[model samples]
Target chain A: MMKRGSGFALSIMLLSALTLSACSNGEGAADGGGKKQTINFVHWRGEDTETFNSIISKFEQENPSINVDMTVFSSGDPYNNGLQAMLLSGEGADVFVSTPGSLFSTLLKSNAFEDLSGTPLLNSFSPDLIKSGQSDGKQYAIPYQLVYNVPVYNKTMLDKLGIQPPKDWDGFLAMCQKLKDEGITPILYGYDVSPGQLINTLVMNLMPEDDSFNKFQTGEVKATDPWFAEALTRFKELVDKGYILKNASGTKYEGALSLFAQQKGAILASGSYSMATIAKQNPAIELGLLAPITTSGSDAKYEGVHTTTFMLAVNAKSKHKEAAVQFAEFLAKPDIAAEYANATGQLLTVKDVKYDSKELIIQSEWMSKKTVFQPRLINTNKKIETALNESLNMIVGGASVEKTISTTQAEIDRNLTK
Target chain B: MKTRNGTLWLFIIPGLILYSFFFIIPAVSSLLLSLTNWDGMTYQFDWVGLKHYGDLARDPVFGKALGNNVKFSLTVIIFQFGLSLFFAILVMKNTKLNVVYRTIFFFPTVVSSVSIGFIWMFVYDPNIGSLNLLLNSLGLESLARSWLGEPSLAIYSIAFVQFWGHTGQVMIIFIAGLQSIPKDLYEVANIEGASRWNAFRYVTWPLLAPSATIVLAYTTIQSFKSFDLIIAMTDGGPNYASEILSTFMYHQAFTYFSFGYATAAAVVLMLIIMVVTYFQFRLLKADRVVY
Candidate 1:
């Protein structure tokens, strides 16, 4: 009898413990339809994220049925580095943005993102934009927000020097000489190699001004073609002329921005993102976006266009797929697009949505003419930037432009294939 | 004593379990991971056996990174050890300003590393930084260069900042070691007519070796693992001049999403550290001091 009683008590205790454990595991996971839904969004957008945050609020108010759990990632490498590791470990966000090149290609091949094909969201977005999001015509992510890298100059300085925006490469050099002769630094450059402030600077300087972004991505022309080399050489000549700050070779991206913002330097080769944010922060200085100087003459066949696509893709493994899709649909609505565009000072990606900012409207017009989204970095060519950085560093170290450019061509040729 | 003997293992068991779960399991898994080409996503992996190790030999960037790591470790090991020893001795010299000197020297170590990186970045600012401003103001314009931006000087520039920040830790450790050394040994040396340098050489130096060894091993490991300084100051840039193995692993795993290859790189680092541990234990093994 005593043994029977003790055995029964032990069984009861074990049952109670299992119940407790099961309840803890099952809590908050069970949800019936029509209840409030929560979506997790993560990105590396930093303090410039205010515009994004306001847009999120507008989203929540309009669709009170959904709640967004936004996580702003720390800036620098950790933002992107740990993102997928978290995803693969089943711990990352439900919806996140990724760069649209080799990283995206690699992720898509791994079957990391949910298919958006033939969905309501798919029909709503531009097919060309989706094509840009895909490899050989399969969609993995959507264009989040498109931006273009352009050259920005100090308007007050330009006016003082009575310089009209240079329509040709020679005129640009003469203007740089004028700025230098006056003891004002001609260019605020941070040659801090690779993905430094160089991204927009070099691209704007080099990209052919005449081709569609689509043609460039589709390989109608090559990045190493003479048009790019001419641009590259012209950009390097500014360095040789000592128009760019000497310390720029060592400058990091942020270092150059802060320097430019302080009005210590005149010419800045950067992005549209720089335009909106710098305008807000540096109230003491006036900024004007101009046609970036190019290697080709004014009548050159190509004009560099600056446009970027930021996508928000749902993680496939999440159980909240329905909710995630619904939230994505909400994001695609014209109203949602307006909120995002207005907040970011970005031109919206949705066709039906009206461009909000004047800058956005201008950029949209430019994108229609001659802009190529920088080639989505090929996976095999992922290390291409390292070569770019090394070459840039070599140039600043006083290496011959001929040697640097040829060596870069050699590296890309050797490595961009398996 | 009885309770200690009885409950020591019992007390240690929880920590041991946690350590095994968190550190040991992950470490073992890293070794397993090193053999595969899993991109840190999904359960799928391609077993490459020793390919990653072989690839390490062919990887020029990895070679550059490894060389950088070794140079950083050596530079930190020497200066960190030297300044720490110098400060420890200075503070222990029974002088009037010793305490104040010790406090000032140790202040940098207490601040965060990211802050150190930022502060140094400003100091090296080329356009309008105080370092250059001061230099130029003093008519030393020729001496001003972007200290952190230059390819040849960036590595040293970063290491010096680290030395300023971490030398305090070594100094504090040495101070403890110095405090424990009996005055009687010094008294005997004084009676024997040995000079100050001679006393340090014969008496103080041998006693400080254990502490020095501990500091050396610690700083060596830390210097090899130095990331925040490089990340914040340069992000291992200006043509990969300041790139270290850890940063390279970081790029592969975090930035480039080649985490499987990155894990392989980490495994190499772990092996190097294990070798270093063995080397330190062999070299620093000393008889126990009774005093």
Candidate 2:
């Protein structure tokens, strides 16, 4: 009886082990006998699915021996959690996308990215734009896209109404009133997630010094400072004047984009990354860049905001490291970068890439003017960023500016202590 | 006799090993991880020894999230429990119409929570939403407001969805319990001239104790796990007013990369659920009930 029971137990244990091993076997390409090496590429830009596939096809045509399998996860928790889960399990992609700032810093600290500083493609990208993917003087990733971090207004509507983009805060207010007079929602503001976007455009011009926000991170500058207060007051002013729609705080990204695309609103308070998407939603809509000008035209130090994001990095643990690096180099080529830029209606960080898309050509005019890098990205701690954004949102929610500032300062102080 | 005992031990060993591998190991590891400052990225992390818990004790967001969780869970339990019990009693006859009603009610439970959240978000949208349009058309424009956007109403709004989705499921359980109660008890109550309410208060209430106990515990757990619905709807936004423990922990780990802090929050959640469930069993004492 004892032997019979022990034999049954042994069979169960073997079955369990077999099941566990089977579940773990299919992650990375461990089959060594395959003739072609396949490298997995993952990114969060589902919108760029077609453009990336086209690029991959060209890359595959050039490197016939190597195959690139691309996967696109939607932005936010799905992509972040999916990638992190893969990394935690030690089966991450060969080449992946990284956002600049906190996410890049976290991955860099964890040594998830390979050192790409030695790659010859480094010289092809603009030095200032490439610095976004660097940490402690070591280049780990290559930032590919240069996006204007300002509103994309309907150029056709603005021109039909004989309204040019505003030159200052007063002009901005006047434009809002004029648009409202015509039964248009002045700004399609989605207070849910775009509070940070709006705050970045406003505070970039409000900074007394270029590194003012960086100082805010190190506790050298308090959130209760006058400039921060002014930024909050400006947000509240937009709310008080009814420039944005009522119950705007409840509107999310899709609803806001839909309203603007349908021409229910005159201006979408979103970045240039959304320009292509807006055009797709309404092909007849002519788009233009509208950076919020806080000072008089001559006194304004910065005409717009820009950020170099969608940094590409090779996974450090990838077996096909050479192929991954080759893919990165291929993307950096000037002609190839221009192809991406024209196809996606995005600006490229590659030094000599040219734009042909009408929307891109018109918005590229802001590239000649002084544009500050998104100051909000200067602080790498997401907690602090969340606090600042919450303060701005609270101000719009009818909370007093002083109270919002106090709570923001307290959060800042607490985070700094950690 | 000795060989029989040894054979029994041999049979139990395999199941014990499997349980330890899956459940016991991860639970203990999470407990240990809560004491460190691990950021969920790298292998290298320093042992902070309760520093995360210390920070959470003073964190105002954590306090608000705890209060929101309690309010959310209680509202779901009270409303969901009452509604399910009422429907279960009404549908106890097991006719064809009643079975169709049961199936119709259970349909939402099978639907994905994320889908439900999206559908409800459109319904609650401030502008161009069906709810506001309905209210306006009915000449109740004053009652039209952003349901999911208001801080005071967001948690409860999501709670209403939670209960609405699962009440059908809970009602099925209660119906089974009602059917199992002996009809002779009701007959005796009628023969003794007891009112319907009195019969329920004495016979049905005590007899339904076992199912009620299970339903109460299940509802509590379900309400505490409202992470997906809350995330899909408000994402604990508009100044963290609707933030609950699960969403709060998720944001800390995934958003803030503070896995250690998040694990501490998880540990607290587990402890709360355990204690609450234990007290529920104690209060009901349904284990002692026998037909």
- Compare the candidates by TM-score and give the number of the best one: 2
Interface RMSD values for all candidates: 2.1, 1.2
List candidate 2 stretches off by more than 4 Å. Answer: A1-35, B1-4, B286-288
Which digits, one per residue and each the tens of the lDDT, describe model 1 over residues A271-379? Answer: 5667666666686566666654464465543355444456767788765677677777877888777777776777656768777665566566665656555532322
What are the chain A TM-scores of the candidates, in order? 0.79, 0.90
Residue B167, model 2, lDDT: 97
In candidate 1, what are the lDDT values of residues B79-154, reduced to their tens digit? Answer: 9999899888778765669878888888988898999999888888877678899999999999998887777887
* Reference-based lDDT, residue B36, model 1: 88
Q: TM-score for the first chain of model 1?
A: 0.79
lDDT of 2 at A134: 87
Could you say which candidate leads in lDDT?
Answer: 2
lDDT of 2 by residue, A1-418 (tens): 5699899999999999887675443333334544556788889987778988999999988887678888777776677777787776666488898887678878887899998886787988989888888877889998888888898899899999999888898999999999999999898877765787888878877889876876776898888888888888887888788887778767787888999999999888889888988888899999988877776777688888888988998889887889889998899888999888898898888888888988788767877888888887877888887888788678766789889999999988888724
